[model samples]
Target: MIAAKFQTFLILLTVLAGTALVARRFNIAPAILLMLSGVGLAFVPGMPPVELPPELVLLMVLPPLIYSASVAMSWREFRNNLRPIVLLAVGAVIFTAAMVAAATHYLIGLPLTVGFLLGAIVAPPDVVAPLAIARRLNLPRRLVVILEGEGLANDATALILYRFALAAIMVGHFSLPLAAGEFALIVAGEIAFGIGVGWLSLRFRKWSRDPQVELTLSLITPYVSYWLPEHVGGSGVIATVACGLYVSWNGPLLISSATRLQGIFFWDLIIYLIEGLLFLLTGFQMRALYEKSKTFPLDDILFATAVVLTIIVIARFAWLYPATYLPRILSKSLRERDPSPPWQWPFVLAFTGVRGAVSLAAALALPFTLPGGEAFPYRDLILFVAFGVIFVTLIGVGLTLPPVVRWLGVAEAGRTEHVAEHEAEIAARRQALDAALKSLDALTAEKEISDEVMRLLRARHEIRVNQLPDSLDPAHHDVSAAGTALTRSLIDAERKFIHDLLRDGQITDETRRRIERDLDLEEASLANREYREGPL
Candidate 1:
């Protein structure tokens, strides 16, 4: 059994790497390719079927993904866009769940409670695919922010609702006022606990002062924040998000430079692996679902899946337009402070409602038997339909989003704003460098540092200042680009020469590594500078 599981793991890693390469080569969204690849692999003759455990996704996979995204988010931006995010994250989730429940119950004749359970499973739009596609396509920053913010918080709403529906079905009773009060308490408690976790984690990392230990702490922080609240009957998502946002806002001052650099690479690679394996595993479950689905009438399952899928999609569209404009129309101050966006903005937001692994996990997590020892109603059917929804939305909306953006021409404004952002970045860099130079001058005057050391330090600062383009004009940008490209080539040549010296015994391996590390840092710095210039 161990060997088989190890072999399956290797197979998944191999497939993941190959599919990622294919996606990059063809300019396709990797999530879409990965899902399709998993499906294809599942049907291969003699292939072992992999069952994705519900707890694996809910406990192991979710926390870090949410935390990493939260850490990457700009807290100021998130706060500024809180209203829309709440509208989508909380209001839209409940509205969509209600819509799905109504449609499935009335149209398809599923029991109301069972329909609602399915609704909670499929309500929240998975932001992973949409955000990846949106960022690559250079969609509006505010739109991306809203999507990201919604993704971070919506899981909490949906999961809490899931619990409510489950209790109503299993225990055969639920109270609206009681559920509402409990929901509010959970949100408030989780947020406070999450922030406390963040503060404690930061203090420990700061005290430890070792990069390896700090990285370990960072790795565990999300789980600590997530598991505690969840273990105590709260939705852990809010706590994780709160912890991440707290870290993002305060971490720069507390975290060491070495830890920050290492942590960025560490988190990026971890997120990449986790997200890739998640989609692939999600796709693999189709085989198991297909087998279980045989117990039900095929037409009934198909109809229910289609109905739920349609309701979720249409529900987003129905809820978003009013959500976008209603607050602005009602409040004079809000209208003045933040005017309504164009119709295309809401349309694009609505169209990006792709479901993912979370829903599948929720459905699969349904208990096998209720408290009275009766089989769970519609468990198999719910799982089948949830998987279907993931399949259709992930592939359908993922593929069409690029063309939709193009057709709507929303990206043109984003592109223009992107260039302006780069220009502002250049200005900021110049100012920061100027400040550093002044500090250096002050130290030189007060501390009586050697003239040689001062000269070299000043020269280094000057070189960095010179690297910034004079303006975002085409000519200046071309010159800066040429210099950056040439610098990279020169760095590559130096690395090769260093390796040759090590091979010939002219330098020790340690010596070669030290030199190579410097070159790597320099190359990385150049790449970062170029990235700030934005896509041409």
Candidate 2:
């Protein structure tokens, strides 16, 4: 079994890597391709079912991905959008769970406990996949923020409710009052754990100072947050997310720009690996789910998956109907700031809340047999249905989102502050070029170079400088510092591309790695300027 599992796993990895290389060429989302690959694998003969150990899955995958995502998110963006985040993350989740529980129980004829369990299990959307797709699509930042916040927050709430339901099943007692207390305790515990871990991370980062060492420290922080809370009977998912948010919001005030960029890339790759493997493994866990079917009918799993998926979608829209707009209305009524929230994007965000590996892991984590040793009730059904929801949300929404946004007449404009700054920098560059021409004219008048050379330089400068906006007088000025900065940023982006190409074998290896050295020089120059003037 072990040898078979190893060979099977290696084959999946090899296929995924090859698929990724091809996906890169076609600009396809690897996560989607992996999902397709998984489907294909299911049809292949002699493929072993994925049997991930519950603790290992949560520990190995969840922490790094959550932390990496959190580390990449800006504190300002998160805080600025906190109100909407709360509405969707906390409010929508609770509403969705309750409604889904009600709907599943009545419509599917499942017991209330089973219905609620299904609700809780599927309530939290998979942040990793949707955010990956959104980023790839270049969706609006506001839309991404809402989705990330909702994804991060809902997971915790769902876990708390799931814990309560699980406890009820095991101990043979269900009490609202106790569950309420447990909920509060879980929230508090997660918050406390996050704060504690974040504090430790910050101080350690500060003391380490070395980019590589700090990076190493960062790699481990997620595991600390995830496992610590989980081991103590707190919400591991919540703690991981909370700690991530805390770090993202706080780490910058305490770390270097180099560290920040490096950490961002590090986590980005880590998330891709973890998410890809986890999703593929979601297919793997199907085997374990199958083992649970000696007693319960297969129809139960089918009905449960169908019932839960419907409710999850229904609950999202139902909650979103009120949740997205209420805050906007309240802000407007009270003459509060930023009244024009992206109310239209909620549906896209809600639909993107696909259940992925975590949901599968959570379901598989349930004790294989109940307290009476009758085998976990409907375990295979739960796993099967969770996978079903994951599939529907990812592909269904992934394909629909772009066309829908365009069709709704609310296609998000890509007009960020950075873009505005880019325009300003263009104006500055024109001024700089004009000043250079003036100096060139003086040198030419002094007969410093041949007329032909001077004429050629003047002609080249004019053609390029002519492209600048009419508002700026090139004859009288130089590019402003802001313009210089903007131009540098554009250069840096190009440099990064070069660096990635060289690193990824898209470009030939050189004796000295010219692109890498160029990037290093550019980076150091940017830092030295920062040193001269305090960080912006």
Candidate 3:
């Protein structure tokens, strides 16, 4: 069993790498391309079928992905858009689930409880696919924040709803008042647990100055957050997200630069691998789901798929438009404080409702048989319908977003945000340099360091300061042009000298690599500090 599992994992990794290469080469979204690849593989003769265990996906795959996203999110932006986020995350999900459940139950003659179960399965959009595309497309900051915030929290809402509905279906009973009380308790427990875990993790990181140890803790944190709340009958997804947000807000003070840089590389690589594997697995499951549902007529399945997908798409738009505009229309204070967003913004948000692996996990998690041993009602049909929603929305909305964004003229908003970021960078760099200067003075007064070392350090930081643009105006690009040019020339000179030494056999290949890494880090630091692009 262990060997078989290991072999499957190896195959997954190979497929992930191949899909990533193809996606990059063809300029396609990796998540979409990976799903397509998986579908192709599913049909291949002699290919080993890979099943995604619902438990493995939920417990192992989900927490890290959610945590990575939450930590990277700007808490400030998330808080700023709290009203709209709550509307979409909580209200829109419940609304979409109700619409889907009603349509399925009435139109298809399924049980209402079963309909709601499926509704809960596909309600929340996947964080990985949309955010992946958004990052590459350089989406407007506000839109990105809203999407991220929605992704992080909506899953919790959907999962809780799914639990309630599934319980009703299985046990033949449910109480709204009881469910509401449980919901409140779960939420409170998750928040308190997340905060407690985050505080302990922060203290541990501060105590252990080892970067390697810190990275390990960082990797374990999400699982801890997920496990603690989940063990106590709370929402693990909410716990992980809350922990990520708390840790992210306090990270600068808790971690050192070495830890930060190393951890970024580790998390980025792991996230890429997990996302690729998850999407590839999604495609592979398509054939299995189809085969399992073949007992039902194909025409009936198609009709159900059409109904569910259409309802899901329309429900989002129905909820989002009014939700976006209604507060401004109703409240003068809200209107003055937060003016109405452009129509295009809300339209784009409404349309980008792509579902992902989480939905698949939920559907696959559905019980195979009820408590009395009868077959779970419409299990195959539910899986097929869930898959339909994922495929249609992911492919449909993913493809349409770029053109719609261009038409809406939101790229300028992104550019404006970039300029503001640059200004903030400049202020941060100024303070950093000031701190260095103060430290140098203190060191000299105490004779803790030599004058030669202080002089060299000061010169390096001064050059970095000079490399920063003097103002936020794009037209002022020339302000740091001279300093950046000189810096680039110096980096190039170092690189050339290093290579020459390697060619002349004065430095071993290992030595060359060591030197090259340092040079690359230096160039990266310089590029980040500079306003405009520079030669490496």
Candidate 4:
């Protein structure tokens, strides 16, 4: 069984990689493409059925994905947009779920608990699809930040609500006050436990002083964050997000530069693989749903899917506009701080609530049997609808989002901010050059470095300093850009020489690798001076 599982996993990985490449080449959303590929593969002859067990997704997939996203989010921006983030993450989730439940109960004729269960499954927008596409688009930074913050935190609310609704179904009773208290306690415990775990992990990594060891610890930290709170009957999603935020904020002070770089690349690759697999698994779900959904009339299933998906989409708009404009209307200070964006921005945000891996995982996690030994209510129907909603939102809305942005003329509101940020980066580079020069002077004064070494170091810094623009003047900008290009070309020439030497067997493989690592780091430093791509 183990070997067979491994083989199947390898096959899926290959398929994911292939689909991702194709999607990228065509500039299409890879999640949708990969999912389509999975669905097609499912129907192939003699292929083993693919199943993504909920426990596996919640345990293995959710933690690192959540942690990486939370860490990558700009804490400053998240704080700045706290009002919207909170409204969307907490308020929007509740509102959407409630509306979905009501619609499902009345329009689709499902029981209230089952409707709530489906609501909870579909409530949280999956960050993966929107974020991946948004990064490529020239979205307003504030919009991106709010979306990311909501994505990072919203899962916790939806998952907690799902648990409560499921429990209510199984036990045949629930108390509002009790549920409220439990919710508060779970959130509190998750926050406290996550912070405690993150602090300890950070300290341990600092003490070890080994980049590889620290990287390994970073990999496991999210899992530990998740498991600890879960073991104590708290929300693991909240625990992981809190832990990620704390560690990322403190990491610059505690972690070495080498470890930070390595961690970034490692987490990027990990997320890419996991995210691809998730979409693939989502597609695989269609097969199982196809077989089971036949128990219900096909037209009824279609009706439920359309009604549920429509409700989910409309519910977002219902919550977003009030959530967005109300605060600015009510608070004079807020109005000044965040001038209300045009109505189109909120509409775009509402449209961007694309659901993905999380919803599918939650749906799949439904219990097969209740404690009373009765088959779980609407299990097949729920799965079908969940898959249907994911497809509609992830593919349909995702495809339309870019064109809609163009149509609304809201595509490039961040242009001025982007320019200002670039100016800041150049200024920082100049300061960095000055700092390097001062450090060389100090070393020379202490006789710790020879005059020749100091001069060489000073010269390099001078060259880099000369290449940076002192003003935002267009002519100066052109010169600075040209100089940067020249610098990169010189670096490329050095790399080519090294490659030639290695091809001619002049250096050992290990030596070549060491040299390549240095060159890569240098290139990364140069690229970051222009623009930093943060964590995954």
Candidate 5:
């Protein structure tokens, strides 16, 4: 097992290093690169299977990954898009599960209980995967919001459904009325837990001035919030999300910038490392699927994959097609004006439904034998299908996303000025260095600064200020331009790393404080892309 883990680690290093170097030098999604590498590694010989405990899987991989995604998501955006996210995450999960479960049981001749279990497992898309691509692709803010919000919330919804399904399977019965009551109770409980935790976390931060204690307290929030709901027989997934949203929205006002940046950075790296390892594990387990099935049904596995993938993709549109406009239509009758837009580009959203670590964790968590000691019917089938869906979505979406945007005119025609503006922004940024060097003239007050000090300062100053073409006009430079998107991402990634240390409680509060200020300044420099591109 140790050798297997080390081998997994080594492969991840090669993949991440390759992604870092290429993405650093050129503009592209590192996720796409990573997945492609996984695909390539699969075809190559000598890649060993990696089997990990479900407990280790969730603990090691989830907290940081979920936290990082939550931090980047603006509270304002999430609230604005809440309804749609609910449709996708809450309403959609049940809708899809029912449809899939019904189809699976009757069509495939599986027991109703096993069928629902199948439905629950495939309900949520990979949250980490889409964000990784969205960052690199420069997807529209609103669209990205829909994806992220739905992705985050849906994970919880899926988990809740899974729990209820598991109970039904174990206890030898399920009640529609009882399920309804349980659903209502779960929803109420989750809301109460989330709202309560959010308020408590904010109060803790507000009352506590010590950044060290504050950061430490914050680290425990996600896990505690997550499990609190679970312990009470509620949904932990939703609870963690609620806690994250609450903390993020409240943290800025109560928590210092230094602490926030530190937390953000620490979690970013933690998630990346976790995801990279998990995906490689996701891929490595292909052989396990084959081995687990004694009466192997290649045709059955293939059929299941095709069916599950079909349900996931179709069910998204199944919910989205009407949900998008039903609210608008209702509101139009009561309001003076109708302004909301139709849910365009269903194809883009549908295809982004990649499964990942979460699904694997859930599948692995399944009981080897049910309460009656009968074999978990078709356990290998579910894992294989889930894995196959993940592969299809990751590659399918990654490759087609760019064109889908273009085809849908998501990249507004005649307005793709980002590439050029990015180029110009890179050039005029020299003034930043010039300002720094000018500010340095005051640093020599302690002494006619030593020659070595002067030399070092001047060299640093010159390296920056000298890079800009001396005459490049800043006035004409496009403020909306994004330099090679890849470069921007790498810079963001590095900044995130510095903070991840703080978030994980691995660094001093003092260091977190400093990095927070740096993050703010860096953010300010690049924060106006929306205004730069739009009309009032």
Candidate 6:
């Protein structure tokens, strides 16, 4: 059994890496490809079925994903786009749930509560897949922000609603007023708790002073924030988001440069493995669901999945237009402060509602037997529909989103804006360097400083300043690109020479490693500089 489990784990890792590489090479969405690959692998002869535990995702996987994304998000951008985000995260989730409940109850003859449970499960759009596609396409910054912000918070809304629906089903009673009040309290409490965790964790990290210890603290912080709120009936998602945002805003000042440097590489690798493995595991469930389907009426399951898929897609469209424009019509202050966006913006938003692993996890977490030892209502059917929704949305929308953006011409504006942003970034770098020089001069006057050291420091600053382009004109950009390419070639030649020295016994391994590390850092900075200048 131990050997079998280890083999299964190895198979999953291999497939994940292979599929991700293929996706990148072909310009396909990794989520879609990884999932499809998993499905294909599941039915191979002698392959074991790998069941994804609900607790694994909810308790173990969710926190870090949310935390990392929240940290990456700009607090100012999130705050500026609060209204739209709330409209989607809170309002749209509830509206979609209600619509699904009504449609499933009246049209499909499922009980209202059971229908609501299904609704809650599928309401929130998965951020991982859509955001990946959106950022690669360079959609408008506001659209990306709104999508990310909604992704961060909507799970809290959906999961809270899921709990209510489950309770209503189990106890055979629910109160609208009481549930509403409780929901408000959970949101508030989780936010406070998450912030508190962030504050305490930062202070602890500051005290630790060891880079490895600080990195370990950062790893555990998300889980600590998530688990406490969730154990007490609150949606831990909100708290995790709050904690991440707090850390993002304040971490620069408090976190040591050594920790930050190590932490970035550490978190990047962790998130990459987790996301790839998740989508693949989600697809592995197809074989299990396929076998289970033998017990149910095939037509009934298919018809129900089709109905729910249609409703999920339509509901987003129905809700987004009014949500986008209605407030501006009613409130003069709102209109003045934030003007309405183009219709195409809302259209693209509606089109990107791809469901993912979270919905399937929720459906799987359903009680196998209720309080009275009876089977849960529509459990199998709900799982089937949830998986179906994930399949259709992930493949259907994920594949077509890029062309849709192209046809709509939305990304053209974003590309133009990106060029302008790049220019501003260049100006800011020059200004910041000037300020640093002034501070260095003041320190030299006040404290003991040698002339040689001062000259070296000033020269370093001047070199960086000279690297900035005078303007982002086509001619200047070409020259900059050529210089960058030539610099990379020179770096490669130096690396070859260093390797030859090590091979010829002219340098010890330790000495070679030290030189290699410096070279790697320089190459990484060059890559970052090119990215900031804008996509090639």
Highest lDDT scorer: 6
Q: Comparing candidate 3 with candidate 4, which one achieves the higher TM-score?
A: 4
Tens-digit per-residue lDDT, 1-536, candidate 5: 88886876787788877776886576565665666666566556777555656666665457556655675678898998787788888888888888778877776777777778888888788887776676455655666788899887787778778888888888878888987888778777776787677779778877887667777777777777777677777767666676678777776788776666566556666676777766665665655665665577788877877887787788877777677666777786523453555344445566577777677777788887877789877777777777777778877876777777666775452234454554567555766666776678766764577889899989977755643433324433333244424445766787788778978989988987787766666555454543443221
Descending-TM-score candidate ranking: 1, 6, 4, 3, 2, 5
Cα displacement (Å) at residue 163, model 3: 0.6
lDDT per residue as tens, model 3, 67-111: 999899877888998888889998999998998899998999988
Report the C-alpha lDDT of model 4 over 191-231, residue by residue, as the tens digit: 88888888999999999999999989999999999987777
TM-score of 2: 0.76
**TM-score of each predicted structure versus truth:** 0.99, 0.76, 0.92, 0.93, 0.75, 0.98
Which is the winner by lDDT between candidate 1 and candidate 4?
1
- Candidate models: Cα lDDT each: 0.93, 0.72, 0.85, 0.85, 0.70, 0.93
Model 3, TM vs. native = 0.92
Provide the RMSD of all predictions against the true structure, rounded to 1 decimal: 1.0, 9.3, 3.0, 2.8, 9.4, 1.2
Q: Which scores greater on lDDT, model 4 or model 6?
A: 6
For TM-score, candidate 2 versus 4, the one ahead is 4
Q: Please identify which of the two predictions, 2 or 6, would achieve the higher lDDT against the true structure.
A: 6
Question: Given candidate 1, what's the lDDT at residue 115?
Answer: 86
Candidate 1 lDDT, 1-536, residue by residue in tens: 89988998999999999999999999999999999989888999988989899999899999999999999999999999999999999999999999999999899888888888899999999979999999998898999999999999999999999999999999999899999999999999999999999999999999999999999999999999999999988889999999999999999999999999999899999999999999999989878877877878999989988899889989999999999998889999999998888899999999999998999999989999999999998888899899999999999998999999999999998998888888888788888998998899888888979889989998899888888788788777788788889999999899999989999999999999899889988998988978876455
Q: lDDT (0-100) at residue 418 of candidate 3? A: 71
